[model samples]
Target chain A: MAERILVLAEQLEGQLTDVTLELIGVARRLAAPRGSTVDALVLGEGVSALAATVPADRTLLMEHPALRLFNPEAAQRALEAVARETSPWLVLVPNTSLGMDVAAAVATRLGWPLVAYCQAIEERDGQLVATSQLFGGKILADCPVGTDHAVISVLAGAFSSEAAAPEPPARIERLAPPAELDGLRVRAVGLERPEAADVDITRAEKIVAVGRGIESKENLELAEELAEGLGAVVAASRPLVDAGWLPRSRQVGKSGLKVKPRLYLALGISGAPEHLEGMRDAELIIAVNTDPKAPIFDVAHYGVVADLFEVAEALQERLGG
Target chain B: MTLAVILKQVPDVVEELAIDPSGTDLDRDSVSYVVNEFDEHALEEALLLREATGEDVVVVGVDTTGELDQALYTALAKGAQRAVKLVGDVEGSWLSTRALAGLLAPVIRELSPRLVLTGVQAPDDLDGQLAPTLGALLDWPHTGVVVGTELADGLVRVRKELWGGIMLDLELATPAVLGIQAARATPRYVPVGRVRQAMRESTIEEVEVETPVESAPKLSRLRAPEAAGRAEMLTGSPSDVVERILEILRARGLY
Candidate 1:
């Protein structure tokens, strides 16, 4: 039998996350050499609608009323059942919060080797090796999973989703979760969605980010004004985000979004490596800070050493927005 | 209710780490160590739980090196009643999940902590394997990156931070392992007096490093990333600078 790679595709209210497609892209890379096939396992209420989107040879759908939202127990049981039946060579998942939980639970249950936050993976010496960042993006560690069945969670945006060619005929299979998990004990009561204002900036282009030098919440308006003038979005440093001045989505750092945008402008931002990891892939990076030695300058394509407010006002006047 | 907080000493986040010429391990000489930041939140959560319930709290450092004394002392300053360091040689040891599970199984059996808390991921390796590995060994319930937690009727109710800060509330049975996220709580600073007191009383026990069930994976190469060129200083009158930036962006296809 040809080797098989399983993708635990995550979705919300029936809509597949972008990370799923990204995983498919990664799976394509891993499966191409071995002539292996990629299978996407989706679990949720009304998840059959996503069958058309997944780029897999087969799409396994487990739809139940209890799974309308993410029921960890049910989801795990379903994925585990599929793994038991398929015996895939590797299991791929996104490194999103839910993906991380499912991957951890599944890996633990099966005693399988797991590599998280994987940016890249490739086959070597008949084993799969993954590249991951360590020491908060200061070091890169390449780890190889020795087991025949390895599980990995790939970071979002780590690999670009390639357009499928000569699209394969996707087949959908319905699965019933295991029944012995009755006493799992965890119950979900409610779900709360973040306000619309708190959107993830990693997906955004033309970002105007503020750092600690912004002084106060009142000064945040200046950055916002510049953002508005540029028709851009607003983001913040870890300190501002931790202080709740901005939503977690707008926080750019190692712990936050890993973004690649068309234009990223840093205003009064002292660049920390953690913050830069989230935005280092920006096509054009412009930093404005009074300190000449600010670390942000190291990655910036353009640097301006000046007062942020004055610089903002000058740019606003020039743009005349 | 007795609480146990697990801490790990890891490499500092800011250092530029290099791999040894051997291509198999990190160059330890160039790195400095610090308590994993998320683990600090785990310690804080334990302290808060103790304060709320008036329960005794013990901090345990799973130290693979004698150097973890500094981290253990820091935990003591943060209000831990006692600190125990599990000393062993973890270097060049793949420290596979099976081995870790085996080692912690005995400790959990002996400690019998009502709840065990650890960081979601350590900064040095960022493998995020410990909590799940330990949970499997003890056959306990496990939750990762929990933002809100409550203890009631021997059950642990937690609000997990899902993608984009979406909240998923769950109720788990006691004797569970929680891998806490850094955003869960504000870590408390250790006091000077407490540090001095902890240094005097803390006892560390060295244990043999468990042999990994699987051998260390081979590394083909290790190299530092090439440094990018210095940024171009776009200096001119304000309008001219803007025009210059626009030109650069356009040429670079950023526009």
Candidate 2:
């Protein structure tokens, strides 16, 4: 094995995840400088087609009935087996829900240094360096992996998926899951859908998102009025959703829906990196926050440094409602 | 049965954080540390479980940055029965998940806790690895981003938050690790007087854990991310700001 970089390709519902391509993009950047080849490992039943879509030098497929769904226990077993065989220089896992669940355990099992939520990767002095956001995105730490073999979970939307050039028809190889898949300590009991109907925020053209600045659950109606005036759908940050003021479908962030709306009217959102990762690419962003120094201002196209309640009422009146 | 809750102190992100002279770390002298928001939720979850099942809840704090003692005391005020602080110079800048996991595995084994609970992720670490790494070191089953948990028939049933609002319902046997995303309710408030009383009455049992000899990754440099695009700030009264936004939206043909 001549300097291999293993990329874990994440997929859902028989389609490759968008973050999977982004991981491949980061892997290419890290590997190209070192004359290393990027190989992708995709585990799922009947996922060979999805694996072939990976833009890496090769795609390793682990297909089995137990691997059909992305329960952590099954995925970990399959990844550990492949990782043991190929001691790759670096393994890139998507920092998605499933990726985060398995990467740390796998790295620990392999005795490799694990870097989580890596935002950027660079080659310094022929060694790999990873940059991660710390202190709620207030600081960036440039970490140089001390060990030769390391596992990294690449943050979603950190790198543009377009940057990864598709290889000339990636070669696919098949592997089998371990024989004793029967005794899983944790079993997936099936997906529990949110109580509300799924309203895909990704398809929304314009959105009005709320955060902790809303102050109280009763104030949600004010945000809704503003959203109704603007002809935009209402959404919220994790705080509001966690408080049960809004359904999970209306939440936007790393652990929530990643949306690229045309106009994102962020009402009182502080623009934590987790939230920014979701709607950073909106064509026009207008933020209303009392704190002028809010990180939301850093990315906003237009901002109002005022209380959200006052701003929402003013906006509602301005929209002639 | 005993439940262990791991607590961490993170920078108070609401306050402005400044880079130190070295440009590789935060200026600790001027900065204030608060218990990690999620870890507080973890402690609250442990307390909730304890309240329901009468299990003993012990808080383990890694006193890496000299801020863990305060958090431990707060945990005591909130409801933890006992607290243990791991005292050592863990070399903050060079600390990696692997190093922290190594330091914790032995301590966890010593406690032999029936369930280990920690925040799903730390603002400082963001890798969301500590709980899972500790589980792997102990070969115990673990789950992350757990939003809801229930106890039934001596098994822990957890609801995991997956991407796009999908939830995964899982059941795990004891001697398991859980990275709590949120508590069932907001952490109960500990009044100032109660906290002061806890400070005087409670003692943090300090255990001098040996720092690992292994070399971990070091943060070579730190830099503020360059602004992606110049933000056109809107100023004036609230009405003027709203009008300005409307004008821009109309110009973009979005309104």
Best by lDDT: 2
In candidate 1, stretches whose alpha carbon ends up further than 4 angstroms from where it belongs are A64-66, A123-128, A145-147, A163-166, A198-206, A211-234, A253-262, A267-283, A287-321, B91-102, B201-220, B225-255
Error of 2 at A126 (Å): 5.3
- In terms of DockQ, the best-performing candidate is 2
Worst 10 residues of 1 chain A by lDDT: A177-186
Off by over 4 Å in 2: A124-127, A145-147, A163-166, A179-182, A195-200, B90-94, B126-128, B214-217
Q: Model 1: which docking level applies?
A: acceptable
Go through the candidates in order and give each one's DockQ: 0.39, 0.64
Best by TM-score: 2
Docking class of 2: medium
In model 2, what is the error at residue A241, expressed in angstroms?
0.7
lDDT of 2 at A17: 85
